[model samples]
Target: MPKIGLIGFGKAGKAVANVILQHPDFTLDFVVRKGLKQEYYSVRDFIGVETDDPALIYSIEHIDIETFLDDHPVDFIIDFSSQESIFYYGESAARRHIKLISAISHYDEKTIEFLKHLSQKTVMFWSPNITLGVNFLILAGRILKKIAPWADVEIVEEHFKLKKGVSGTALKIAEILHLEDEQINSIRVGGIVGRHEVIFGFPYQTVRLIHESVSREAFGNGVLFVASHLTDKETGYYSFEDLLGPYFQEKENDGLC
Candidate 1:
């Protein structure tokens, strides 16, 4: 079983942790949360244990990643933390030779460049959204763009009110279709998990490709899938698309259209 360290305790992180706990091939080794102590009795309790079994004690520790690398041996680290957290821990993780899978989104250009630099030293995977459906949409958008090079393309993404700016998934699809930032629209509303639509306008017809995330578990499941494949990968930068590309190719061979 691969030992894992998780960063952040937000909705996505918590959801991924739950799925990890249920799986047999992975072990939840450590967690990095803001202001966590050095040691803990139970991982569940530290992260708000919700199980019915009161006596289930799994000795997992929590620490800020600054101190985490000094004394721990973790096979992989999955970060759903803030961009600031990634900036803080990126070098340390590289120094410790830890593979990282980051799901944080909307980083500035400088941070993105820094992560790319860090990737040269450590195995790193970063994606705005990890859901397989969204990546498939990206693939679809690319194919559509190739088929209709003259079509005007635009992206509209909707998220919960707390989300800021356009989604990374939207930006990625735009990049695929060579669409500018002005061509993308962002809507923030109530409690939406996530939704992205790519519209292509031709002379007299329009086509739309959409992907909607119904639950955070979709992301968790995607993370689990990516983690399993990324563990022994060579030191380099990667995205969810890189991990799933072969599967998509297989589907294409089997008639994806």
Candidate 2:
């Protein structure tokens, strides 16, 4: 059983908690947020832990995260907070050698460098999208890149208006396809869950790869699966593909398609 601490109590957080409670091997220690003061929030109705307490948020102190980690600690930390918060939280995790998992839309050069630095001392599993199906595409893209180096590609991503824009996850796929940031297109509309399309343009015809997330539960399930394998892992940063290696290996054993 793993003692998990979750950060953020937004829509995604609530959905994740429902799954966490059902998993017999895991426990939801606490949830941390900016301390919203309302008569009631819909998310609070569903999740048991809803508070402004920073002490129980995976031992991360509100004022100074790094200092708090020395005193309080847990098995693993899941960050669903803002981008800035993740940078601070990740730095703290690195210092205290805590196993960190982030299933958010934050992925920048600085975060990558921080994770790489922490990998030498602690484990950090970070991904823009943790959904298993999407990870399979990421793996496939890597293989395809090797097979066809000059596959002209374009990416189109969509998310809810509440979400900023084309997520870092979609941009990551573009990176895999060797498409620059400028080539990536974003569409933001009302209350969309998540969607990404990777199209390869060719002289004769075109090939397309698409991953659509209809519900937040799908993402939550993937997070739980990753968390299950993350505990006691080697000190380093990992990706969804790394966690799903065995499944891919089985596919290879059966014979490459």
Candidate 3:
């Protein structure tokens, strides 16, 4: 079983913790957050679930990352925190051959280079959008574009009002389909989790590919999905498309209908 370490305890992290514990194929090691009154939190008690596993939570401010990692080594580190969180676990994790899965929405070019650099020493994957539905939408959009290269395309993304500007996923879809800036649209309103759609306009009709994240569990599910596939992979940089592409190989060979 793969031992997992989580770097964020936010809503998505909580949901993922539940998912990881519930999975029989993996084990939850520990969670690292900035500050906490307690030295450690019982995963089962904190999450209100019954489990024999002794997963715990530790505050980043209180623990020495290197020492903690050495004593309780983890197979993979799931990062849902800020892009800068990489600095906290990057070199240490790479030295231990720990895999990295970063789902942070955005990162500067320098941080991105560091992520890629760490891949040389460990299996690393960086996907701003790790939800399976969204990546499926991206893959489906790419295949459809091949069939309808002349189809005029428009991309629209909607998120909660406080979600700031266009999501990295939106820009990713736009980049995948080779759409212009003006062709991409963004709407922020209400508390909608997230929704992204690509419309292909044909002379007679239009086709749309859409994916909406209704809950944070999708993040955990996607992580599990990717982690299972990477178990035997060699140290290198990877993407969701890389792991998911093989599943569509048969379809691609069949002409992607």
Candidate 4:
């Protein structure tokens, strides 16, 4: 069985855990956290085990440059931790030559530098949203952008009020579209899981492509796919785009069949 470590116990983390449990080839090794045992003991019941010592951690919380390097002979690290945690873990993972998969979208020059340097040391996958469908939109948007180069583009994303940060996925799509930062908008209202729309307009025509995540389950599936794929890879950066090639190729093959 391939052993994997999870960094967060949030909505997406919990959802991915359920999917991992059903898989025969993957086994969750540990869930890392720093709070009182009581706070995450419930998590132990859900995934299994609790520990503060980095060496003892099946999953570690509060990952950083020094801590990750000190302990763990992990094959791959899945970080849903935090923006800060992502950068720290990412850098450490590269230095140690450990493969990393994360859902973090924000990246600074240093972060990008870390990824580029790590390109040879470890394989890294970073995506704001990992759901398979969202990546389809990304690919589709690329083709659409060339065809409608003159179209004005704007993005709107909605998340639950308690959600953190602006829409990482929204900003990513904007990055893909090469839109200026001012063209994107993020909204947090009641308990929405995730929803995003990319609207393109010119003169009298408007084209709107939207993705609505009905539940956290969509994210769970995406993460499960990542874990399943990454657990056995050698090393290099990846994204959902890499995983979806088979699906897209199958569609092309179907036409011939």
Best by TM-score: 3
lDDT for each of the candidates? Answer: 0.77, 0.71, 0.89, 0.70
Candidate 4, residue 4: how far the Cα is off, in Å = 0.9
Task: Show the lowest summed lDDT stretch of 10 residues, model 2.
Answer: 52-61
Q: On a 0 to 100 scale, what is the lDDT of residue 6 in model 3?
A: 91
lDDT of 3 at 192: 83
Model 1 reaches what TM-score against the true structure? Answer: 0.84
lDDT at position 126, candidate 4: 78
lDDT of 3 by residue, 11-102 (tens): 78888989888888999988888768434878778888877666888889888889999988989999987878999889999999999999
Query: lDDT tens string, model 4, 1-257?
Result: 55566666676776766565555665665566444343434443555534322222333444444675565456566766666666545666677766677776576777766766676787788777878778888777777899989899999888999877778888889888999878888888999889988998989988888889888768767776777777667777777877765555535545831
Ranking by TM-score: 3, 1, 2, 4
Task: Report the Cα lDDT for candidate 1.
Answer: 0.77
RMSD of each: 4.1, 4.3, 2.0, 4.6
Better of 2 and 3 by TM-score: 3
The candidate, 1 or 4, that scores higher on lDDT is: 1
Candidate 1 vs candidate 4: which has greater TM-score? 1
TM-score of 3: 0.94
